[model samples]
Target: MARYAILVRGINVGTAKRVAMADLRAVLEESGFSAVRTHLNSGNAVGTGNDGLDPAEAGARVEEALAARTGVSARTLVLTAGQLRTIAAGLPYAAEMAAVEKAGSRMMAHVLFADPDPALLAEHDLTAIDPGNVQLGERVVYQWCPNGLLESPDVSGWITKNLHVEVTTRNWNTIAKLADLL
Candidate 1:
C-alpha cells in the first residue's frame, strides 16, 4: 500500500466552503481509503490505499464524496507520500534558503495536478515572482512571498488562468506538517 496526501482547495476559507476535517476523513474512509486522517481543519488529508490507486481517481472520488455527503464542491489534488517527501526535501538545500527562512508563511508552494505545457510555461514570465523566489519542481512550484500572499505574483492563479491547469497552494509550515502526516 502507498500513502497519499489529499489537498482540497477553497474550503474552510471565510464563510463559503466550511468542510469539517472529521467529515472529510469519514468520507474518505468510506470511499475505501484506509488509515484516513486529517491534519488541519484547512482541507488537508492523508490516507493509505493500494499501490495501484491513481491520484486523479482518488481526487475525483474525494470530490464526489464531499459533494454527495457534505454538499461542498471543491478541487482536490492527491500526491504520493514519496512525492510529498520529495517536495519537502527539495527545500532548505537550495540557494533560496534565506528567503525561505525570512518568508515564513510567505513561502508557498503551488502543488499542481499535472505537468503543465512547456510552451505555455515559457511563453510568459510572472514579473512579481523574484528570481530566487520561484523554484519549479516536479508537479509543483515553490515561491516566496516576502510581502505576504497578497503581494506575491499569484503563480497558481496565473497558471490556472494561462495554462488552464488546476492547482492548490500551501505554506511551508503546512507542507511540512502534511509531509509528516504522510
Candidate 2:
C-alpha cells in the first residue's frame, strides 16, 4: 500500500464549496482507500490506498468520487507521503519566515502543476518581491506575504498571466499539519 496526501483547492474557504471533513473521509474510504483521515477544515486527506496506484491516479479517483458525491468540481493535488515529507522538509527560511508570520505576515505555499515544466520556472523568474518573498521549489512555490493574501502583491496573478500554470496556495501552517498527518 502507498500513502497519499490529497489537497482540494477552494473547497471550504467560504460557504460556497463546503465539504465536511467526515464526508470527505467517507468518500475516500468508499472509493477503496483505507485508514482515511483528514486534517483541519480544508480538504486535506491522508490515507493508504491499494498497491500500484500513483499519486496522480489516486488523485483522479478521489476527485471523481468527490464530484459525484458532493456535486461540485474540485481541483486536487495529490502527493505521495514521501513527496509531502520532502516538501515540508525543503521549506526555506524556516525561522525567518516563522518570524514574519508571527508578526502578522502570511506564509503561503503554492502547489504548482503536477508536472510543472522546469522551463516555466525560469521563464517567469519567480523572485522575492517587496513586502513578500517568493521562492520556487521542486513542485512547490513558497511566498511570504508580509501584508496578507488580499493585500500582498499578486503572486498568483503574475504566475497565471505569464506562465499559465494552474496552482493552489495553502498556508504553510496547513502544509505543516498535513505533513504531520502523513
Candidate 3:
C-alpha cells in the first residue's frame, strides 16, 4: 500500500462548494482507502490505499465519489507522500530568503494538477507578478506574495487564468505541516 495526499480545490471557501472533511474522509475510506485522515477544513486528506491506483486514477475516484456522496464537483490532486515531501523540500525560497527577510513577505505555493505548458508563463503577461515573487517548479509554482494572497488578487487570478490547469494553493506554513503529516 502507498500513502497519498489528496488536495481538493476551491471547496469549503464560502457558501458554495462546501465539502465537510469528515464526509470526504468517510467517502474515501468507503472507496477502499485505509487509514484516511483529514487536515483542516480545506479538504486535505492523507490515506493508504491498496487498490493500486495511480495518482490520476486516485484523483478521479475521489472526485467521482465526492460528487456521488455530496453532489459537489471538486478538482482533486493526488500525490504520493514522497511527492509531497519533495515539493516541500524543493520550495524555491532560498534565493529569495534574504529579500523576504528584509520585506517580510508571505510565501505561498500552488501545486498544479497537471504539468504546466512550457509557454504558458511567457504567454501570460507577468508584469503584475513582483520580481522574486514567482518561481516555477517541476509540477508546482511558488509565489512569494509580500502582502498575502488575498491582497494580491492579480497574481492569484493569473495562476488559474493563464495556466489553464487545475491548481490548489497552500501557504508555506501549511505546506510544511502537510509534509510533516505524511
Candidate 4:
C-alpha cells in the first residue's frame, strides 16, 4: 500500500459541495483505501491505498465516490507520502518569512499541480511582497504573508481566484503536524 494525502477543493464553503468527513471516509474505505483519516473539514484526507494507482487516478476515484455519495462533484488533488515530504522540505518561505506566534495567524505553502510557468511568475506583480521572503520551488510556492492569511494580498483570494491552476494550501504548522502523522 502507498500513503497519500487527498485534498478535495470547494467543500464546506458557503454550503456548496458539502461532504461530511465521516461520509468521505466511508466512501474512501469502500473504494478500498485503508488507514483513512481526515484533517479538519475541508476535504483533506491522509490514508493508504493500493500502490499502483497514481495521484491523478486516486483523485478521480475519490471524486467519483464522493459524487456518488453526496451528489456533488469535487475537484481533488492527491499527493503521495514521498511527494508530500518533498513539498514540506522544499518550502521556500521557511527561512525568509517570519513566524507568527499569534493564535490564528497562519504560515502557509501552496502546493501547485505543476511548477508554475516561468512566464506567469515573471508576469505577476510580486513587488508587494518582501523579495527576500518569497521562494519559488519546482512544485511549491512559499509565501510568508503573516498578518493572517486573508490580509496578505500576495497570498489571498486573488491567487486562487485568478490563477487558472489547482492549488492546495497547508499552514506551516499543519505541515509539521502532518509530517508526524506520516
Candidate 5:
C-alpha cells in the first residue's frame, strides 16, 4: 500500500465550498482508500491506497468521489508520502522560516498543481525580495513572511493568483502536521 497526502483547494473557507472533515474522510474511504484520516478543517487528508496507482490517478479518483459523494467540487492535488517528505525537506532554512510564525500564517507552502508559466518570474521575483525568504521547489514554493502573510510586501497573494498555475497555499504548521499524518 502507498500512503498519499491529499490537498484540496478552497474548502471550509468563508460560506462557500464547505466540506466537513468527517465527510472528507468518509469520501476517501468509500473511494477505496484505507486508513483515511484528515488534518484540520481546510481539506487536507491522508490515506493508504494501492501501490500501483499513481498519485495523480489516485487524486482524480478522490476528486470525483468527493463531488459525487460529498458534493464538494474543488481542485485536488495528491502527493505520495515520499514526495511529501521531499517537499517538506526542500524548504531552505525551514526552522528559521517557521520561527517567524505569527498568527500561524507567517510561513507557507504554495503547492503548484500545474506547471507555472515561465513568465511568472518576471512578475514577482521572490528571491530578490528577501534573503532566504522563498525557495521555489518543483512542486511547491516555500515562502517565509517575516512580517506576516498580510504585511509581507505582497509575498502572499502573488503566487496564489498566478494565472498559469493552480496554486494552493498551506501554512507551514499544516504541512508539518500533514507530514506527521503520513
Candidate 6:
C-alpha cells in the first residue's frame, strides 16, 4: 500500500466550491482508501491505498466524487508520503531559523511540477508578492505569505494562469502534520 496526501483545490472558498470535509472523507473511504484523515476544511486528506491503484487516478476519482456530490469541480494534487517528506526535509526556511523567527509568521511551500526553464520561475514579479516571500526550488516553490492566506495574492492562481504546470500549496502547519503522518 502507498500513503498519499491529496490536495483538493477551490473548495470551501466564499460561496462557490463549497464541500463538506465529512462528505469528502466519506467519499474517500467509500472509494477504498484506508486510514483516511482530513486536515482542516481546506480539502487536505491523508490516506493509504493498495498498490494496484494509481495515485493520479485515485486523485481524479476523489475529485470526481466530490464534484458529483457537491456540485463543484476540484483540481486534485496527489503526492506520495515519501515525496511530501522529501519536500519537508528540503525546506530552505528550516535552516534560516533566525529569519523565520524574525518574520513572526508561518510559511507555505507550493509543490510545482519540475521544470528546467528559468522563464517558468520568472513569470511572476517577486516584488508583487508583498511581505509574502517566494523561492523557487527544484520541484517546489516556498512562499511566506503572512498577511493571512486569502489576503495574499493567490500563488496557485498566478501559477496556473501563467505556467503550464500543476501546483499545490500547504502551510507550515500542514507540512509538519504531513511529516508526522509519514
Please tell me which predicted candidate would have the highest lDDT against the true structure.
1
Q: Estimate candidate 4's alpha-carbon lDDT, on a 0 to 1 scale.
A: 0.71
Clashing pairs in 2: none
Q: List the residue pairs that clash in candidate 5.
A: none
- State model 2's lDDT: 0.77
Per-residue lDDT of candidate 6, residues 1-182 (tens digit): 88888778767868778788888888788766889899888888899988767767877888778777777788887777877787777776665444444332357777774453568557656436554366666567777655556667777666666666777777777777767875
lDDT of 3 by residue, 36-81 (tens): 8888898888889764678898788888999999999988889888
Alpha-carbon RMSD to native, per candidate: 2.1, 2.3, 3.0, 2.9, 2.8, 3.5
Residue-level lDDT for 22 in candidate 2:
85
Per-model TM values vs. the true structure: 0.90, 0.88, 0.85, 0.81, 0.84, 0.78
Off by over 4 Å in 6: 95-105, 113-132, 146-154
Residue pairs clashing, model 6 = none
Compared with the true structure, the alpha-carbon lDDT of candidate 3 equals 0.78
Candidate with better lDDT, 4 vs 6: 6
What local distance difference test score does each model get? 0.82, 0.77, 0.78, 0.71, 0.78, 0.72
Model 4 agreement with the true structure over 1-182: per-residue lDDT tens digits: 88887778778878787889999899788766789888878777788888877788778887898888989798787888887888777766544444445422356667776555567667775434545445665566666765667766555343554444577777776666566677
Model 2 deviation from the true structure expressed as Cα RMSD, one decimal place: 2.3
lDDT of 5: 0.78
Top TM-score prediction, candidate number: 1
The residue-by-residue lDDT of candidate 2 on 36-136, one tens digit each, is 88888888888887667767776777789999998878887788888788878878757666566363237777787565566876665678453337877
Model 5, which residues run further than 4 Å from truth? 98-104, 115-132, 153-157, 160-163
Model 3's TM-score against the true structure: 0.85
Over 72-177, each residue of candidate 1 has an lDDT whose tens digit, in order, gives 9998888899889988887732455453555548778888888889898788664345666777787888887777888867788777887778889998888888
Predicted candidate 5 versus true structure: per-residue lDDT over 1-182, tens digit per residue: 89988998899989999988888998888777899888888989899998876777767887898899778898888888987898787877656754553534677788877656777766766576556777788788787776777765554366656535677789878888889999
